[model samples]
Target: MIHLRSLQRLTLAQRRRTATGLRAGTILLAAVAATLSRAPAARAAPEPVKVVVVANFENGADQGDAPGEFQFWVEREHLDHPVALRGAPDVLRRGRDGLYGMVLRHGVTDLAAFILDPRFDLRRTYWLFTGISGVDPRSASVGSAAWARWVVDGDELREIDDRTVPAGWPYGLWAIGADAPNRLPSDPNHFGSVTELSQLSKAFPLNAGLARWAFDLTKDVPISDDDAIRRARAAWNGFPAAQRPPFVLMGETLGSRRYWHGEPRTRWAEDWVRLWTGGRGVFVMTNMESQTNQEVMRTFGRQGLVDPDRIMVLRTASNFSEPPPGVPVTASIGDEGPGQRLAFDSNERVGAPVVRELLAHWTRYRDAIPGRP
Candidate 1:
């Protein structure tokens, strides 16, 4: 009977220990689950984009074809991933280096469509607008590149036929509210007054410091100069700036839907840019899309869709805005001359470094723009 009681006591003790062990395990598991439940959830990674290269057009296949504004970039950058937007002619491409390139149509419509699409986010994006344009002979020679400090609109103006313009008027084109050419329109504050743009403004100033930075970064980079280029530049004898070899500079751009040529029109562009910018801007390049593009970007900026301060415009000189000495306006207007190829080469040479710099130290430039305090 004593042995039986001892065994029974031992069994009871064993049972108690077993029950306590199980309860402790259960409590430990419950504590672990509670802690996990209180912890924050893992967040999705942000969409990575270092730089977005906005090119105007492409000539052929993105690779293994004759180069265009977009082709060299696509090929050189190894932009292999293609994302096709439905109902769009060009495909958006991305590289593993966090670079995105898109060949936007020549005007505002396509850019607006791309920006409005829900497929991508661009609020943190940096835009580099680049293309070939008619270079003002007084500013820079063909094959030269200009970082625009201001983009002036040449289309929103009043014009009469140059032949029928009143005597002493340089050209028929003038500000919408102005009574005469070369005159700034009255301020909108004036009673019953039509002003420079009425309710709209003509000049869109880009980041001046940024332009200077880009110009400084690329100004020393060698531009393409060949026998063809030398021969083409030789014709600009009277214009000292145009006779020089290609280079990089800071200048302003004038954009219009209509393509106009001739010495008189060139003078008009120069004066128009100066008037709109309150004499702070100098016209250097001419194109068909910049004003419209800047307008769309400004609207997007107002809506919080983009940061306008991050935008940069780089235009290389594909041709002269007006004829060389003794060349007919019609002949010179149609010919891009040898500078076309030189411009293409110069654009890539000058733009690639800026892109690379942004990419190399993305941690710094991702939030802070270069040349800004």
Candidate 2:
């Protein structure tokens, strides 16, 4: 049974096209409000932060101990004017130099409101979404990281119960205007399908050039793996990516709040990302926050509050969305281990270098995109 509150919020966003998929019928969690107010991010016309590090949640022991996401990004920098936004708690950290950091509450509402906040000077900043997510076992393993080239929304679709779906149907899901799975959506532009490609019915493509540059810089960085992950990965000895030690890769991501799992859902995620990107994107990570974040950018991009070209998303594998060959989905759903720590470590490893570069040469990046050296 779907949560009434979840469905209610979804309905609200669809009705109010620009609504931040939050506050439709749901109350904003205090966590979201408290996070941004912790420091007090403010400034009428203060110096613009060059880079902003965005992390979704602070859970587990690593997160509890660290001052912020990726640890060093916050500890090493000095933040000023922690202006708290009313609709959401958007804590902005001004690096000891010129960088910034924010820990986002795990929801679409806060994500959208923060950018629209008057205090955020996104014009001269590089918004880097740094977080961990579930990886497709066929594509990656714990500790592996990916730079997203495209972000697809998997939630905007019509569906029938699997039990009542027609024969040969993959699942009960299909495009909003399409007749069946894998078919062209009839009303691609019904709402905000303006960018829908022939193959993708609901999606957004970030700056391809920027994604390439980030991938090129960190593709070869050595990713540390551990015995816990190795032993966990042993269950998937047949899958090359899952068996190999963690590494960095360039790929695409999908975001949805449904949190479905197992092979069928995994296949849907892969196909959805591929179909949306028209075969150019490789699907790897599954996220819950990116799609909402993208929506906010798209909404404000028109008002000159945001630059879609200046944004990038980085995802690291904390666990597989589905169990391996023999493990059941039920067992894998709640199984816990060191994947959390590995995810934190790898996310920082793959993303820190880029953050450092932007901080070191803020003058060059403030007015221009950096070229690959």
Candidate 3:
């Protein structure tokens, strides 16, 4: 028989081993539980959304965050895996495969809020700014669409009343560092006089390759026509492109905050863009948001959040910037008729195909950004 002390020692040793094994098993289980809990968060992060459409309002109606003039792009395109974006002034709607859209109120402030929102991962995103704008009757008709090469800010200028303007000046408005209206300094680098706009808001030019690529994709796609649009085009008799049915053409934009209208203002827009672009651009679309959009992009671009070069602005004509040949400005402003609808429809008409092409060939462009001339 064994001694009691030795037996007790043997039993103590067995109990110690059992306790150690149990502790190890418990620790392993705890580690597994911790890992399992973290899986949900990893799954929750959404995939990156590409191809964002920037729109301001509903074509006719707001269909519960979608099917608006901007939202329609989501449904018609059948975008998938949509997730509502957070950390914005308002939640922006985003889709997984390709389409994403945001509705901005009519100003720089509203657009700035949305662009500065932290939740969006705009890196590698291709921003498509689609909106309805007043058309320059000289450049396009009521339903003509122009792909902008230069987005010129129309608000920044020195102005005198037209009645007291200097002789030979086209209008009251004059760009800084210039002798008179329509006169821009020959040297872009050195202006003899220091001007307010020299450092403030001025102009942004889109990537020529991308703008041209877009035009090539949609140039031949026939624009939808209707009675109202046809009647509007009839008034643009002298302008060959405008007289033809609604079509896509490459042009430029003038963005202003004042909403100034009339024949004189339109002439100013043309000259302003010409001066800013060194007479290389023709003003076709008059809009309110292009300058605002670029300002936001410039910030994001430095942070590597968005590629400013990839951003493209596409404007469709909703009304004439000035009255058609004989129509009075006051009467024309209120009577846009069906061209409003056509403008919305035409944006999608040209925009949709280019979007489709990108989606269809995702493999080629997934890692590489397109638009090389």
Model number with the top TM-score: 1
Q: List the candidate 1 regions with Cα displacement exceeding 4 Å.
A: 1-48, 187-199
lDDT of 2 by residue, 223-327 (tens): 888888899788896888988899998888888867777788888888878777777887899877778677666655765666778889999888888888888
Regions of candidate 2 where Cα sits further than 4 Å from its true position: 1-44, 60-72, 76-90, 106-120, 188-201, 371-373
Deviation of model 1 at 308, angstroms: 0.4
**Ten contiguous residues with the weakest lDDT in model 1:** 27-36
Name the best candidate (by lDDT).
Answer: 1
Cα lDDT over the full model 3: 0.66
Q: Regarding TM-score, does 2 or 3 come out ahead?
A: 2
In angstroms, the error of model 3 at 161 is 1.5
- Model 1's alpha-carbon lDDT is 0.75
Worst 10 residues of 3 by lDDT: 27-36
Deviation (Å) of 313 in candidate 3: 0.8
* Tens-digit per-residue lDDT, 116-160, candidate 1: 444567787788898899988988988898999999988767888
TM-score of each: 0.83, 0.81, 0.78
Residue 266 shift from truth in candidate 3, angstroms: 1.6
Question: CA lDDT of 220 in candidate 1?
Answer: 93
Q: What TM-score, to 2 decimals, does candidate 3 have? A: 0.78
